[model samples]
Target: MTLKFLVLSSLALLTNAHMAAFHKAMYCFNGTASGQVNYNNDDPVSPLWMLKKSDYWFHHVNQCDDFPPAPGDFLELPAGSSFTVEVAANRGVTSLSFNGQFATDWGDGGNHPNDYSVANLAGAPLSSSGCIGNPNMHTQNQSMAAGTAFAISYQSDISQVTMDNLAVFTVRYNTPWKRVTSYDVPKDMPACPADGCTCAWVWIPNGCGEPNIYMQGFKCMVTGATSTTPIATPKPPVWCEEDQSTCTQGAKQILIWNQAEGNNIAVSGFDLSGNPKSPAYNSKCGFQDGEGFHALVAIGNVVSDTSPQEHRMTSLVHRPLPPQRLQQLLHHPHLLPPRPHQLLDRLHQLWRHRLLHHPHHLLHHLLHHLLHHT
Candidate 1:
């Protein structure tokens, strides 16, 4: 038995382990707002041609050299998964580039007091050539612990009029990113969920327009994989020992009223009042149950259509014995064994649900006022 457990544990670990990943879409020339680039090539129509990317500079000459910069200016990607970033090749995109060095201010050309590696030249653009032959300038590792940060300089080479075929994909991990553990987010794809788990449709275009251009660097990736939190149906507050403390004893009672005519599902309504009455039943009103000179409120508690059959009989025709401020309890957790109350609870539950969820019900105000006055 121990051996079996060990094997299963190993398998689970193997399945959970994952690599770094990114989602890539068409690289528009120039930033979208600046009109520096456009999407060309794929069905949505992303196109690529002989246009080598300019030097890696944003805003000012030495602007992006600073640390803790904005997202569009730089990136710090993990290497757990095999990341193969290729730039659209019109002519000069040769390889990925980058280094760990960064600057917060674009010092003018030649202004370093230390003068360690230079005499002058402050705003000189850094290159991602830590190694060479790559333009996205990158680092490779298995994990990216929290708080780890890196800086890299990169650019796309527009040296030649290369083909326009869209980039390709290769798996780097053993388990699937979306299905196995985390949810997969595609760069060029948008997904719409519907009908509470009944069904989902994925919009995927099998092809891109420019079959030759390659995209550079990290893609706007999806963060977490938690889809939706499951909610279990709440059970009715039964007449259990735990609830005895909350209920009033001896001739005191709570009145729950059911209004839904059928099992049919509709919208919702507003009815916070269930039992409204004497001060004893409601401490705020100076009412005490069974002991003091307290009276019960007129409760409008919603009972469902599928209430337990045993409770229905008591609910429809419950008669209490007269007590001298002593022991005639009305609404107790202990359900009457012989009452026919099935279909009552579910009906009430549905009505309340509709009232809250579909609050724009045309007859909400009308129905609420009518029921309240009655």
Candidate 2:
């Protein structure tokens, strides 16, 4: 039993050691130049390793060279993921052309950098020479060596990658100065999100034609898998033609109204034809849910119907009628035919007053006045 236990323990140790060696941890560039050119650090250097990168830059110049983990270093990229790298350091005006090195050597190679895609590495591990042959890799020439920022980017035709793997890259200043960053790119793409998660047509408040209102960078690029869900644009309220047939003599006012699909719709009325036959009355009003909407429009004092057969009467309904106008209306009642309901209501109101208390006397006087005039 002891012999069996020893054999199992040996197998387990061998397996762990083999797995550790399987990654074959890669090395960063060691600056060996004399007098302030060398960076002293052990393998897998601190703070500056790349894990997952959506977009990244290494700002070594301008005192931005502090060691910090790369932002977005841990990423679960969908298929067809891509990235760009930028260098802002001055490497001098020499015309020598050199490619930024990105390497596939997890740990096996010297200070050489790797530019190969994680997909390619998963398919077949890249040699140092293979890393150099990448088509989308960036090359630095004398023109770009003057400390101006320059960038290079690459995309992989290969769709997928295996997880738990490392991608390493480095840029050289003088003497192949290597402070490289490494990333752990993800294998599987994230699941597509639930629907209705995005704004289909973002309602820009009054954003129709004004150039001042515009979409932010994030909103502009968004597109749904299906055509963007269409939003029901709020419709403007509309005014319908008012009924003119109901206009009659002695009617003090009429109501004007409009219909709208939206809650905020407002309504107004205008006198399009100023002709006396049609007359003019303007109105303004708003709407609410249960209370209903209406606008009061004062009837015109003077009425001239388009047809000659209709009786013509003028009303002074906008304000209190002048004494002279009232006298004229009272003496010539034929001009303003009294509506039965309005006249009866007026009589009832007058009966309540002390001045014309007796309905019998009022009726007798009105009859004599009408008959004598006729």
Candidate 3:
């Protein structure tokens, strides 16, 4: 019994040593891990190490696009809803089920036996004291973890998609941390083309590991969309971690860091807080949820289906009242808009102004409101 135990322990150590530390999107359409046997085979879905501005930068040499899903096998993104994706060190740990077919299960490859445990699921393994020990996962301090984002291109054909049109509609902070993660879709996102939209999940870890990034493609379609206002052109994100006023205002593109070519933003030094600056997917990187809606409204790109109340609010922001008229309304509350909903609309107008001009103040007010209301 003693000899057998020693042999098993030796084998486990050897296996772990041979395994590479990397992760990929498992459930993404045409994911490379469809039928992979080695749960730790990070080759097919390997991270882009010091990538250049070539085809490889786009969905890893376009291999992910090679295995297109069958008709109707798309990653569904319901408008005003959220979708979950399974991310793992390898596909073997996942169900390997896609397009109404089940692939071979080569076991969990002993890489993540504790992943499903209650403690692990609840993030017990992640420590706020520092980065998680596993280089494959994200840091425990969510604010410190490099963020991840989901960008969508209106083009249904993956080949037709380009960086300029791939607008990032949503961002997830402290991501690549768990096997199962969820991302919120914008309520006002426009519907995709008939063949469905081409989406990509991109990520870049803050630190405590390699400087590589991840980009996986997916065939997705949005349902229940009531808006036809197309997404605005995406510009490269800038490092506005210090002064949010400098942050990009409209739709933003994904970050391409540490690459030889096509690197949009660079943070080679520390930030105002004296921490290493890393462009992420959160507010620091100019990616605020629902910013698309606000941008469109601010630019007078209001959709036709917007509610009457919303239209009134948009008009109020664009068409400011004279000082005397404003003072008259302010002094005589009775002269203001009637109905409780109109009052709420006025408050929303104020909120929108605060959000665009004084976001920090708006955040403080939001926290205060949540504390008192909830």
Ranking by lDDT: 3, 2, 1
The estimated TM-scores of all candidates read: 0.14, 0.15, 0.65
lDDT score, residue 255, model 1? 16
Residue 278, candidate 1: Cα error in Å is 83
**Could you list the CA RMSD of all candidates, in the order they appear?**
26.6, 32.8, 8.9
Task: Flag the better candidate by TM-score, 2 or 3.
Answer: 3
Q: After superposition, how far is residue 339 of candidate 3 from its true place, in Å?
A: 20
Which lDDT tens digits does candidate 3 get at residues 56-93?
44555546556555677777777878887655444434
**Ten consecutive residues with minimal summed lDDT in candidate 3?**
99-108
* TM-score attained by model 3: 0.65
Candidate number that wins on lDDT, 1 or 2: 2
Q: lDDT of each structure?
A: 0.21, 0.21, 0.58
Q: Worst 10-residue stretch by lDDT in candidate 1?
A: 195-204
User: Deviation in angstroms for 149 in model 3?
Assistant: 1.3
